[model samples]
Target: MSAWFAGLLLAAVSVLVGCRIADTDAVTPVPQLLAFLPWLLVPTGTGLLLALLGRWWVGVVWGVVVLAGLAWFIEPYGKDSEPSGPAVASFRVLTSNTQFGRATGALLAAVRQQRPDVVFVQECDNRRCDIALRRELAVAYPYRQSVDGAGSQGSVILSRFPLEPAPGVPAAMGMPGAVADVHGHAVRLQLAHPMPPVPGGLGPWRRELERLRDFAAAGRGTPTIIAGDFNASQDHAAFRRILDTGLYDAARLAGHDRAPSWPSRTTPVFGVQIDHVLLTGDFSVTRARFLTLTGSDHRALVTDVTLHRR
Candidate 1:
């Protein structure tokens, strides 16, 4: 009976931890752990082991509770069923930080292999980045903006499609942003490399996230995609609210949500997903996944999306 009660208690705690992640604000480091709520599975799994020692019924109840939490927290990344109809237009997009403009070769290789229609690169405001951009991406991605000398305030956008400053935005604001004409579909895109959520930087991080949220709110009807190292995860409240602003996380939409994209050297199973590609409007995510990239602490995210008929 003691074992059974302990198991039930553990199970309840695990469930709460998992559910509360999305609501966890970045006030202090404690609640910030919510960004890694999936890790709660470790404790939840232990509770299952403890319950089995008590009785079959108790074990079963604990199992159901634990599994329910897993399903809820991870369902966004769950495998998706096949779609019935065809889409009107489709294209590939990639977002990579380039690790402060250090991973030139790796970035080039990934670009060559992925062959994305549009690329959003953060930390690209440097000399080495410019050399690589001219040598490797110049001919391939003809329409480029803020590619070099973008500064810490914004990012660079390289695209095969015709790229221009987003309409009505006077100047490039918080994030590196632009609008790309993808086979006639004008899609708004931004490279969002917000300040990290470290102790000293929490204040700036919150403001950066709020800026993105405001962008999404203002661009309600436009097809928008915000992609980069958000530094916050699906569990963070501010990040979740950004999604609530009408953007659908590409990985989430395609049920590939568990694929982590940061701290690249760590095991994919345990790494936190800080990189993301979020979309709004009639974009349908057909494929989304994180890929290995050498020379950077972060992994790259790619997504194939199909647009609805206008």
Candidate 2:
């Protein structure tokens, strides 16, 4: 095959990879592929390989397209100048799906080690499997809340500090979470599990994202921080809209977005990041990273942040 033909294929695939992320009404029917955008790097690297095959100019063209994509779509976050301030308080927060039923002792061990001030669990709705964790968690987190939805993995939040469920406030996130009273500052914390943006499921996914955005607008009685399996990444336009509303992804802030969190690192190269810890402008992320979990397709997300009174 001609080197030009190979280069052409690379450029064509590059464009296809770049156009997968969308968050709008116009493309509601499109399959969500942003989660795999990082794989585009494969082609970016291929461009370099093309030059070795003697298609130097074609390689240059392919390289330009892929690099521009990296800048335009996957730019490294946390490169922005950080806000200077004396942190009112710093705390550790952890969010994990806990898979379905594998609530092994390793989970408890990690929690004990991390000593997260706030913990959010998704898919623990199977009372027999996940809800049972209440006893183990209570040892470390005296304040706890969990909602075993009718089915699936219900959500739960365990905190070392006082946590109160907001009355008359509706989050419509389809799971349970709580408002944390941190040293007199009320921080509305919610565990979000939006519907996966799969074919025939995009509508509900989009709606859930919009609801979270609306909830943010309805005047949270206190600052809010949402952490859970978002099911969608910043590559999704819908997720980006949520972040634009003064909320920040701690992983992005700590330069961890490039790291994938799902599909298990057993095949690390193919995994994509779908889980996140989102906080409002009320806090500045101090540290963020993923934690290894036992028997989970997802890698647990852990973050530390300093609260800001605005």
Best by lDDT: 1
Give stretches of model 2 more than 4 Å off.
1-31, 44-63, 77-85, 167-173, 267-269
Flag clash pairs in model 1.
77-255, 77-257
Considering summed lDDT, which 10 consecutive residues are worst modelled in model 1? 167-176
Best by TM-score: 2
Worst 10 residues of 2 by lDDT: 21-30
Model 1 clashes, total count:
2
Model 2, 9-76: lDDT tens digits are: 56655555545433343343333545666566666666556655675775766677666766676765
Candidate 2, residue 58: how far the Cα is off, in Å = 7.4
lDDT of 2 at 198: 72
Model 1 lDDT tens row, 1-310: 7476656667555545544644556356634556676776666666666677666565668666766766676545323333344566789999887776776678889999999988888776567765678778889998876634544444578899898886322223335578888778788888787788777667777878888888889888777888888888877777877888878888878776777887888848678888998887567887887888787788888999887753
lDDT of model number 1: 0.73
